[model samples]
Target: MTDARHIEAQIYERLNKVIDPELGRSITDLGMIAAINAVGATSQGDGDVPSYDVTVHVELTVEGCPLSQTITNQINGAIVSYPDAKLTPHIEVSSMSHDKLADLVAGLKAERKQNPFNKPGVKTRIFAIASGKGGVGKSSVSANLAATFAALGYDTAAIDADIYGFSLPKLFGVHTQPTNLNGMLMPVTAWGVKLISIGMFAGADRAILWRGPRLQRSLEQFLSDVWWGDPDVLLLDLAPGTGDMAISVAQALPNAELVVVTTPQPSASDVAVRSGLVALQVPMKVRGVVENMSWYEHKGERLEIFGAGGGRRVSDQLTETLGYDVPLLAQLPLDPDLREVGESGRPAVLNEDGALRSDVLGRTFRELAEGLLRSE
Candidate 1:
């Protein structure tokens, strides 16, 4: 009937607004809506409007998709809320046919052929958080900074470039493996940031599954195989004692800027200079340095726990050696909440509502993020 056809068409149009949380695309656009059938089930009485029952057939990309229920629920809401007449929704779901999935993946791959960040006119601002050694709170800075960027309304993505010592998964509290669509992988989004880490990969042979001969391939694989979709900012939490990883990041993301993290002591600050000096070997720019644990506040006095001026020393050394100004960006406090709440799967810079904390440490990271976005 014309009424049925018109209602079905209207339902399809409504579905365009329902996006798949994992893909960040509409189910209708992804060919997930196999069919939509609508019919007048009954009328209330004489002079009363009729009620229609709409049946939606959905074909998902993967079987047993964790978000399948979410999509169906959205579909139900979209149809049931139609104001012209009363309506009920029935959603039937199934996995996509092998041929359909293959075609979809191939089309997507063809559309996105190589590393999206290296595009000629890419707008993504990439920052590789590096350190001379471990335990300098480099990953902590990376996690909080990415969260801050997202809180500031940027579509942010982060790669745990520290393959061997991957911790972003734990820091961000991501438990589910990435949704693999054919050969392409979807990054797990948490705290409003898209994230990818080897630690989040599943399967028994997960350790060696995504790597090749050189460890650099892991970084490249994260760039090529993941569906990033052109984020406004991309943060890479690089491994400590960096040489290969820094070089790899430069080669992979040509526009990436390096942000070095160091503590307020001689031993950590000395090697921190070497980490920033990596800009000499590659074409990457050395963004300013962040000094972590500069001081601890107890009672009414400030205590320089690790000694002061370490961040400034690294900045001065890098500026002199690299012939560019590498300023001291921020002096982060030695706050215990950074580790305690961070271990609980959320960045310390953010509150429970995912808003940037208005405290000292949070304000410092917000300024760091804003400064990174400014032109030199």
Candidate 2:
């Protein structure tokens, strides 16, 4: 028969492999596994194998959390999969007390150390999508790019740094506000991307929300106050401007790369180049340029409704001025479906199931996402 001590130890080992779905950490390590008790069900040694009734006490971070069932199922599987013994699993679920939850959040924040991404030797690839002019589809590109990154198996997070004119929440179809854990906020996950935006705080009456001087303070709050974990890619949808927000991004995230978005018209491309020139003033790198609304495919013909060569012109200008190759990354087609689907609360690159679509639009975004990472 398996001894009580042995059974308890084995249960812990299995539980260690069962990660908390939301936090992406081991339940045992997170202090979620409150207790484990095992007692023989039948006679101690009826035969070669022993059957035991195992009860596991799980304390969740929040009550009625969406992922609680997923955590419990994995715990049950861990107990039932023991090879040397036959185990009947009984799982108990409960939320942590007010004081305990606060402590956990405090410890996590302390360990994370204010701003995790800006810390030295951080592995996150930060991309700030900026444009000199609005109505150039910068936010759409950011949303689609973030979704593409997530679909490509990279942990992705997006911040709508355009506080006054936020659009990530709408384009990504996120209507829920972040979960307030103690003082830290949990970013709402949508389209497989963890996202936080000022739009999410539309109905909030908190005074902490941005009022007038939103350039630096707002960006700082998004970086420090939100729990982003360690995402592989972090995309920021900056407000359409030439200076203030871009300078703020450079000051806050020194390691951030700038991705300029523009259209095929000269009017947009002129400002787009000036926007990328902010990298000259700051210590940011001009990663590349994305040309949205380049063409519309209809009836087996490519129509350049928005004129042409704006993306290439911006790329060439940035490369010549910066003395480095600022390649034109991809030319995204002008599809009404992109707007329609996005208004429905989903990125155009992803399907209703949140998986990457198999169509041309998806392929273009996938290539763009891969190219950005490869060049990094």
Candidate 3:
């Protein structure tokens, strides 16, 4: 018979593979595994198999969390899948005491330092999605592109840096507020992406930010006060305008590249080119332009409802003005389903399963995501 201590050690090893779906870290690593006890073992009818009752104590960051069932189920699976023994798991779940949780957050913050992204040689590729004006689907593009990047197997995080006009929480259908550990906040994971936005907070919670210096301080706090872990890609959905927010992003995230969005009209394209010109003022690089609502398809015929050539126009202007190859990255279709699904709180590029769809819209976003990453 396998010794109880050996079986207990094996159970801990199995638990190490069980990750907290929210934080994307192993339960053991997070100190969530409070205790494990292996009780009396019994032999099965087969004579060769051993069965044991295992009790696992889990301390969640928040009590009665929405994902508690998922974590429990995974833990149960880990115990039952033991090769040498048939284990019965009893998982006792509880929230960390306030003082203990505070200590945990403090240690994490001290280890992370401040604003982990600003540290030297960080691997995250930061993209600031900006538009010259509103109604050009900038937030939608940011949501879908961030979803696409996450679906494509990249560790992704998106900040709805739009502040006064935040929309990522709505688009991603995130209804739960972030769990506050002491004063630090955790970004809610939705549609396979880690997301944060002003919309997720109540008015009383948001009022805490009112004391800061407007946009710059707000973005700085989002970077420093949140536990983003180490994402492979970070996309900021900036407000539709020029100068201030762009310059703020440059000052805060020195490595962020700007991706301007515009519609297919001379009016929007004119302002779109000016948005890219902010790169010349700040040290930020103009990644490229994404022309949203470029065309509508009707009965197999491509109709330029918004007028054509705006994307090309902006691309040509930026290349000439910026002295670099500022290409037109994508021209997204005027799909009604895109808006419909988005209003339903999911990115239109993803299916009901949160996986990237194989349809035309999905392919277009995938290509755009690939092109943007390749440019880096």
Which candidate has the highest TM-score of all?
3
At residue 264, give the lDDT of candidate 1. Answer: 90
lDDT (tens digit, per residue) of candidate 3 on 210-310: 42267777788789999998899999999888846677888888899989999999999999888899988888898999999998999999899999988
Off by over 4 Å in 2: 44-48, 202-213
Q: Write the per-residue lDDT of candidate 1 for residues 119-231, one digit (tens) a residue.
A: 88889999999999999999999999999999999999999988778899989999988888888898999999999988887642245433424768888789988988878
At residue 142, candidate 3 shows an lDDT of: 97
Summing lDDT over every window of 10 consecutive residues in candidate 1, give the lowest-scoring window: 204-213
Q: Worst 10-residue stretch by lDDT in candidate 3?
A: 204-213
TM-score of 3: 0.95
Candidate 2 lDDT at 13 equals 92
lDDT of each: 0.89, 0.88, 0.88
Models 1 onward score TM values of 0.92, 0.94, 0.95
